[model samples]
Target: MNEMHHRMARTCMVYTSAALLALLPVTACGDATEDVPTKTVDTSALQPGSYPTEPRNVADRKPANAASIREAIRLAESMPLAMEVDKQYVYNQSSSGKIYAPELPPQQGDSVWVENFGAVIPGLVVGWTSNAQQREDFALGRNIDQTVLRFSNPDQAKHAAKVLSEDNRKDSPAKRDVRIPGHDAAISYVTEQDSVVTWMPHDDLLIYTFVTPGLEVPPDVDYVIGMTKTALDKNIEMLAGYQRTPTDEMPDLAIDTDGLLGRTLPVDDMNKSGATEGVYSPHAALHLRGRADVLKRAFDDAGVDLVADAGARVYRSSDSAAAYRLVAALIDQLDPRYETTDAPAGMPEAKCFKKSDRRSSRFTSIPQFQCLFTNGRYVAVVDAAQIQDLHQKASAQYLLLTDER
Candidate 1:
């Protein structure tokens, strides 16, 4: 809960096998729950936001090439994935980025699907998003974002902008052309959604903004336009940086954050502003590299099969009626019914467990909560600690997976 506690709380999230969980009950969370209290800090004398200012020293900093800098930005904005990295608690939290070819899904030339962007403008060079975290923010939600796509060259960028402008003018309502600083940008407001969308072009990058779903209240037209301006300003600064002093190395970005969660359930507990270092709890921490050997053996022992479909890996059972039963049995066999936690209301009958009891020094002190349940034809492993309300999000995820979308 506090800064020092987070560091000393260096606990790992373990997807403990039944055989493994047995080793802990005697001296861990089941019986021995004593933990050293973390030390407290005094914020009285220090300013609440005190941080080290940029130093005046001028050694060991190497500026990268424009291409490398651009490439780094592109890597940061890899699409299909959510905005894992963005401007955080810093003064500037807006950035433009693109994805390298290898990181994207397998494509056949023009067959790429822009996952984060609207999937319309093809060659996505500078897909930008903002961290305008505030209340009542649709097209401008801090969670949802908008971006414009551009190709490699200026001619391509201008051509894409032209196509978007023509399409917006013909199809979008309340169409208007506005100037951003020295550039002419297209702005459109849709009455049906009460949201505004904008597109601007500068050199090789195409900038755009729109309403995205948010956790808080839905956003309105004014908030979108204002944030678009903010995004545009940040874009101008980034492009300028590319021209002038390039960064030695790009700032670190968030990692691909999925390990123990169900395929349908998304786990993004890392703070966008803080990168991975700003984790709040084990709710978002699941690193299952060395932890899945027993899981594989268990599956093999039970006759369940694993298969890959459309880039996603899923566990399958030969019999449809017995599928859920088999999956539940695996968990039950490992963790008995009496030891299981009751299923949250609306969720299928479930059992819960923690991978580690923090019984040993090698194990993490952090607590990892694993919620195993069944939904429809599949057994679910929902890490309730990953999200705020485990029941609601897991239920919603189950419904969304069942839906026709």
Candidate 2:
């Protein structure tokens, strides 16, 4: 794999998908439809299973807004996220939908979560990387790292840096001051491999990075110090004043796409109509009826709002296979409460249920296969749109979750 993929392909990519027609009026949903030259970013440029990491923008570049965010997403969408998972490597196709990682990431899923800042997201450590070598080190559970963390504001971010620095200086017998970036900064070296963890306070964000090899790899403090200087130079502008949002259209998530039941590429795959739209993260209208609180708690735990009426239309495919594909992609990304263990007979053992709200319309309940399940985090779920079996249009995608390997 190329270095870029090594850096950017570290799990925690949140998969979200919907049917082509599930999302309507492309202008809505914050998608930019400007007529730009058509371009196909073949992933080969970055090596198999990876792409270039987004350059640091908030610091030197203009802060990103809704329009810019959409433009980037559109650009990323235009590219094909094809990885050569050919027969060479033996991938455990099962277990591809684990919501949280089994261990501290570089694992998958739970590696990247929204920063809680004060009380919201705890134990949430954000790391940024741009080097392929370093990327491999991180994924393999090594100490070499170069990841970025964003915050709502600069004050909170700087305070966080200070706290981190203070906490990490106790690793050595002779308590010495940790090396920080600037005179007004504090630093820490928690491990010998990670010589110094410098926190650079930039506009609207804080960058915590290290360039030193593991303490065991080399004790070249000079080299380590040089990297610290480089980090300070590149991230100087990233400190404070500029306030904006962070967006990386490239899906950094991982899932076993081959695990998808029908691995054979269908010539007339689900894209028969050139369907390019997939509804991901749409507000689901769940009827509470007498179970308002019960459903509300479910929705709350599910991290979505439960409404008696939904503003958007949720269309179900007439094709059972197409519909099955849609629901499968949804399960792969949404991580909904599909733990009812209610899969259909003869189908693979999956946690599926026919539980639907009373207000369910014909659109959601199309005449087709309605079961849903996915492999736990076995493979990376980069592109949901590509997974829907297009050739199997006439039939429904009645795939089953695989048994434990």
Candidate 3:
């Protein structure tokens, strides 16, 4: 079948909520009418060539003063629960739902099992298998958060890095917090400006988001991250665990991505690279060229009156799931299945929604909303001026990046 036809057929993958056989229909071999034996590929055996090799220079390199982090938690103790916020999204393509929490979870004291669902959500991209190492380190009270956040396992970390950097004009550096196992502990890293971003994992439903400034070291974001880490540690046991389970299961993800075209190398439609004994995709090279072309066209076709990619990618903004939920709202409008309407109040609306000059600057102008698309599989965020052009070109891009979304 042709790519467009395949894209349409994949919609069945997104909409199947009934029979189990229908779950991965596109993956089904032979004729649809044939009652063939189901073939299941062991994910673990997919090989490891797709992972990245370059080291992420921004992971929490050193541990913060334990006393300082604990102190930060103490300061946040009195913060009103009313100030806390939770945002959620249910992807129509893959029935797996996601929730984002801006406020730190409440905590008791020691012997804590404080699982930050928001922070945990980012790890879902690689299946949170790395957390197994963190869990072991957590039991031993070692710096497991550092290992997990550092992108230690080459295959998964590299895969994540490949997808993340696909649209790279540059990498923005930012502060990231890696949770310590037992005590109210954390490791902090001061990322090169626009160079580092956070990927908070929630079991397998990873949340690719950014952090808000608060406790900063030397009175900046670095210090704020430390304070936030400390606060989480102090209330470790007190913080609430989300009523969500972690898994790779996605339901009702019907999508017609055949029109989507990608510059990135094609690898299992998921955009995963380095599979099967470390073979690299020629597609990565293509992705880089494509990103440059799209960006150049965006500047020329639409005035670069306001530039966003110059800062952090909005998906890497304060709450990524929130960012995606907003995009989901737009996608829901574009495609009806994405109709869940519960977003956090005061949640900033998308900047491109309104053409008015005043409204145009409202959301996009904020640094919080600055985000970019990675791996062609993730959500794409365009500046206000480029929205129309993006919409015009979206179908092909969607097929290329998500191919099935």
- Ranked candidates, highest lDDT first: 1, 2, 3
What lDDT score belongs to each candidate, Candidate 1 first?
0.33, 0.29, 0.23
Question: In candidate 1, what are the lDDT values of residues 1-405, reduced to their tens digit?
Answer: 221221122122222111211111111123111311122212222221221212111112212122332343342333211222233211111221222221232121111123242354454433322222222111233432334344566566666666665554433344333334344554334423344455666666665554322334554445545555666665556455443112223233221222112233322422122111111111011111112223333344333443211111123433333344444444533432223444445444445554443333233222244554443344444444432354444444444334232
TM-score of candidate 2 against the unseen true structure: 0.32
**Judged by lDDT, which candidate is best?**
1
RMSD of 1: 21.3
The whole-model C-alpha lDDT of candidate 3 against the native structure comes to 0.23
Q: Please give each candidate's TM-score.
A: 0.33, 0.32, 0.22
TM-score of model 3 vs. true structure = 0.22
Winner on TM-score (2 vs 3): 2
Worst 10 residues of 1 by lDDT: 278-287
Choose 1 or 3, whichever is better by TM-score. 1
Cα error, candidate 1, residue 313 (Å): 16
For residue 145, model 2's alpha carbon misses the true position, in angstroms, by: 3.2
Q: What is the C-alpha RMSD of each candidate to the true structure, in Å?
A: 21.3, 20.3, 22.8
